[model samples]
Target: MRLTRVTTAELDRLEFHAVRSGEHAKVAAQLLELANQVDAGSEISRAELFVRAGEQWEFTQEYERACAAYQRAIDDGAATVVDARALRAGALLHLDEIGQAYAEFERLEADEPSSLQTYLHVAESLYAHDDLAGAERWATEGARLFLDQVGDPYVDDLLQELLRIRFRIRADLGLAEDALDRCTDTD
Candidate 1:
């Protein structure tokens, strides 16, 4: 498929279906070739293509390539800055770059303090790294933020997840008394 002759919309459709149908590697290669053919001034389009390439790489379990693609997206100022950063942090964590991942999450949190997604990602990352205290702190903060700012019913779902994570952290840390107190408070 010589995508050079195709319109941007066609390329998008092809790439989307290709990735969705589990032809990530093939789609990524096609995207790379198509990217080279696009004008240099198309930074936004290029960034989006790179992000899609990163997603393909991630789906195929290629963490390094995914991270590189996400970084390229970041450099190009892709529209999905939050998503790209989050995926990059996740890729870094998968690569065992714990410190770097933590830094990325922290930077994202600072940049988007009101974002529930950022809070959840930070808390989950901390939990994965066995930082129960940090996880609990972030989860609690997120729950409070959700309660104070978002009156949506969806906030309850998030609160439930946070509560579950907090309970797990408390149990893992041997804080049975605290856990019992939490249960009582909930009741």
Candidate 2:
């Protein structure tokens, strides 16, 4: 297989399908080989491959390995990429590095204040860290942002899912009124 011409986006899609088909180990090795094929100074490729490897390790429950891959991505200038920070933040969260994850998300939020996934992640992480108020605020922000910006009817299903989770989390935190209002609005 001529892997040299493969793009990072292609590798990412391949990795996803590989995981879905339970070829995690195969995907991991392929990602590592991809990393090796890139020159050390090829920061963009390095970051992307490392993130792929990290996600594979995460799926395999190799948290430490995942963390290392994410670290390599960072070391390879992931900070310069479009969604690198989000990927890094998600990796940190998966590794249970809550504080670091929070910092990364906060930084991303500051820069891209209306990103739905970022807000969703921040809310979920905050809820995990037992910050109900913070979680509620983030979830609310995420839901509103999604409604305002994401207009594809194809995304309606996901939006409904987000609404469900938001209400459930809010209700869990005793924000029943707010949850009810949001639910009605979504309907």
Candidate 3:
């Protein structure tokens, strides 16, 4: 389908629907063609289009293309900076660029110190890299920060996940007894 003179909003809606319906490749091709045909005027909007393209590439497990798209979005200063960073980091990890992936996650964490999601991402990266000690440290820090917000259901869920990760990391490191003691003390 050739889309001509359609507003970006309209295109976004169509793309969303297409993705939801699993017509990702078709929609992705349309989006790429459209991106080349139109000038979005705003860097942010263009960046968003690139990010969307990256998402489509990711759905197809094209990590290299996804990383390229995400990097373009980042370079354009897209509004989804954190999300782009996280996705790019994940793509790098899948590509076996562990150091680069860790750097991206660290940058996200540094920018959003209070973000539970950032902490979780860092912990998960460490865990995936077999750095049990680093994973446990990050998970413990996340749990500590989340403890005060336990009344919030979402925070509670995050806290629980952090605790679970910490326990698992400790167990993997043969510090299960220490993990038990820490949990007991926290309770």
Candidate 4:
């Protein structure tokens, strides 16, 4: 479908699922090429093209190229706040700019409190840096937010992961009793 008539968010959703399932790389090249297509001398489409290319590069772990593409999108001002921040954060994380990635996630969380993914990323980064206490806090907050407020489609997956992380954090902090209590059934 032509981009002008098609919703960008819808296309982005499709691309997200494709990348998640590892099937979008080939289609991604085509999307990237189309991103540069200009209609009636407008640069809008070109900006979107770069953003999509950046997203594809990110999915493939080409961190530097992904960041460049995302930077182009920002310079073009075609990316929405949520998309831009998320992509930039992912690229920064891939590049091992953990502090920058954490800051990005913090900004995203402030704007979107229901963004479990950002919380999860923050927690994972903190954990990687051996900040178990901070990671535990983030993981607990994410689990509670998802389970209580959103009940999102990813709840089960997030919950399982949270459980694991919580256990690890507790164990590492020498709270084995607390950790075991959580892991066991209360019924």
Candidates' C-alpha lDDT: 0.70, 0.66, 0.70, 0.65
lDDT of 4 by residue, 1-187 (tens): 4543335674677687776788656656666656555453443456666677776776787788777777776677654422556567667877888888768767766766455555665676577667788778777776666665434546656566666776677678787555433642233
**C-alpha lDDT of residue 31 in model 3:** 60
lDDT of 3 by residue, 151-182 (tens): 78876676677777777788788884654336
Clashes within 3 Å, all models in order: 0, 0, 0, 1
| Residue 182 lDDT in candidate 2 | 55
78-123 per-residue lDDT for model 1 (tens digits): 4652366766887888899988887887787677556565567667
Per-residue CA lDDT of model 2 for 59-165, tens digit only, reads 88776777777677767764433244555666676667878877876776787654455566566656766767777777777677677545676455555665666
Where does candidate 2 stray beyond 4 Å?
1-3, 7-13, 35-48, 74-83, 90-96, 128-130, 179-187
TM-score of 2: 0.66
Per-residue error (Å), model 2, residue 2: 8.9
Candidate 2, after superposition: displacement of residue 85 in Å?
A: 3.5
lDDT assessment of candidate 4: 0.65
Pairs clashing in candidate 4?
35-49
Q: Rank by TM-score, highest first.
A: 2, 3, 1, 4
- Model 1, TM vs. native: 0.61
**TM-scores vs. true structure, each candidate:** 0.61, 0.66, 0.61, 0.56
- Model 4 worst lDDT run, 10 consecutive residues: 178-187
Pull out the clashing pairs in model 2: none
